[model samples]
Target: MLGVVRTLTALDRLLDVLPVLADDMRVETRFAVAEGSAFARNLADELHRCQAQVVTWDEATGKDFDLAISPSSNGPLHELEVPVVTLPHGAGHHKLRATETGVAQEVSGLSRDQLMHEGRVVPAVVGLSHPDQLAELRRNCPEAVPRAALIGDPCFARLQVSLPMREQYRESLGTGRRTLVLLASTWGRDSLFGRRGDLARELVATLPADYQVALVLHPNIWNKYDGLQIDSWTRSARRGGLILVPRLRKWQAALIAADVVVSDHGSLALYAAALGKPLLLGAFGHDEVVPGSPMELLGERARRLQPGDLRAQIDAARPVPGHRQLAELTFQDRPYQRLRTLIYQRLELPEPPWPAHPEPVDPFTP
Candidate 1:
């Protein structure tokens, strides 16, 4: 209902972008739909494309099920009984009250009073990355932290499957002998660098001859603010010998191939951390979109350097000695199996086997 702001905050939910889990669980969808809204229209189109059964809540009554899911802080949270579950639309360390989707007043954004009510009421919650996450949940929105086992993030679990080989990705994206640096922008205007698409130019101008930068943009960045400038920069950079990664599938592939990832508190930093590569913090912790995701802590994990020090930092960044595992802490994997198991456990239905492989992903397509 907050339109673009909400759309940018939780596009995956807006598009109904779900992962292909093991079983064909019938997904009956309901929308607090705002007619004529561009985001609403996009959501309807995406849900149709996903072939989900769209139904109003009234139409969905009496369906035999173990649980109903909101996939966000809101979604008919009230008017339900025990065992109704929520899968927060976004992840990390922010309070539900702080998100664009968490109004706590409207059905889209549940009011604080209602949230605490639900917190004491709902049986379970899904998609928490770490055990410590719950402390904040209970501390900040005690009324909303559900009373059940916190399931690991299904999205992160699915993302944990092995990625495409670096060599294969290198050949496809043509990084050749140079080290690959992915210059990512979550919100170019508000990132620590405080400029739109200009960091790529700065990096390109200063990086050593052996390194090549790849430009990958968040959908919000290229879509809402800097499309023309991004395109122009990408083209000019490509001519000057940088690689311009394709959107969606190719972008995911580029993530796998990146030797170092640079971002200003974007999800890419989190994803790159999941990939177990060295990360370069740009925005530090400037949270223009949503403050305090688990990702905002990446500045602690990565090397913080000025724009001029990027190349040198990359050179100096080696694994942090022994026993210091990186990135594995980011995602709790097994999301496909977890959801199916939860359905079986809660609904007394049979669980499906895990997918046999790590299927290809398109970061922008959904």
Candidate 2:
């Protein structure tokens, strides 16, 4: 059995990549869950056809596995006895320290020295999106380089379901006018570091009479901001001619329907970038590590949403070029081939046939 630990942020990537492993290998894959989560249940349902086992810490104690895989860097590393592989999590901009005792590897450019300091003794592998990240990994974690493989993110291997429910939801909300989708994520209060409810109210007050706005509240915010009624807030906006969508059948579907998106530095922004949706990055608090901010990576496609800069930013964003091709390149359309081959080589399993197409380009560059 191969043990896989996953984080909610990386669930889409995991689901896309792991199914290929099941198709090619004889080993059984079981997932270790941190807690019961809606995303976990969704993942289980998605992978049910693959026959992967879902296990908790108590049930995983005596389980045997040849290798361990973690979808995010933040998952508990000490749980598995076998070698571990990790996907890049968080900013993916800075180099993390690596260690010696436990083997840690990344699909981005992180150096061995950096990895060593971060408790990752293993080398970092280059994934599809960032070749620069691979170079950094080689520079920082040289020891783990040999084991490093250049497979892309698993999420990119399979195509995401672009459902037509966006139109239905829009009609349900009566938001036929210009619409903006706000994906509000909770990075803890300290990290969220931006405007609070007052900010939302300010934006609502300032929105043009013709424009309608929808707020997709983060699932975590319900618990964090206890007793806060998203419906009431959205309804207030609705009365003002701006329609707020508090409930979504599928988050990605909502993203597809949106003309523009406002979010902080979360993975959902990446999805918006992939979909060629104009982005407005709200940099409320993460000044220390983010530097120029992840929105800078989107180049001219997005701008930082400031207190009074909303109108200008939205105006500037109107002519922004979409990068659907770039998204396809970074999130390779069929990444399972590369991932499967790399895993086989690492575990000394026989290599499988390569897919018909060559590798995709990096979406970050022209």
Clashes of 2: 27
Summarize candidate 1's per-residue lDDT along 1-366 as a digit string, tens digits: 011112323545333224433335544334332232223334444445545455444433334434555555443444444355555454443332333443231222233443445345442543455565566556545555555345555544434443645566676666778898887765444553355456676677778787878887665454454446756756666666676654323466677777887766666666666656776666644433323444544545566656556678777764222212334444445555555566557655554554523345443311
lDDT of each: 0.51, 0.49
Any idea what lDDT model 2 has? 0.49
TM-score of every candidate relative to the true structure: 0.70, 0.64
Provide the clashing-pair count of each candidate structure. Answer: 12, 27
lDDT of 1: 0.51
Q: Which candidate leads the pack in lDDT?
A: 1
Indicate which candidate wins on TM-score: 1
Instruction: Return the lDDT, model 1, position 11.
Output: 41
lDDT of 2 by residue, 164-236 (tens): 3456545545556665545454344422223454445556778676556655554345433422465554456
> Ten consecutive residues with minimal summed lDDT in candidate 2?
357-366
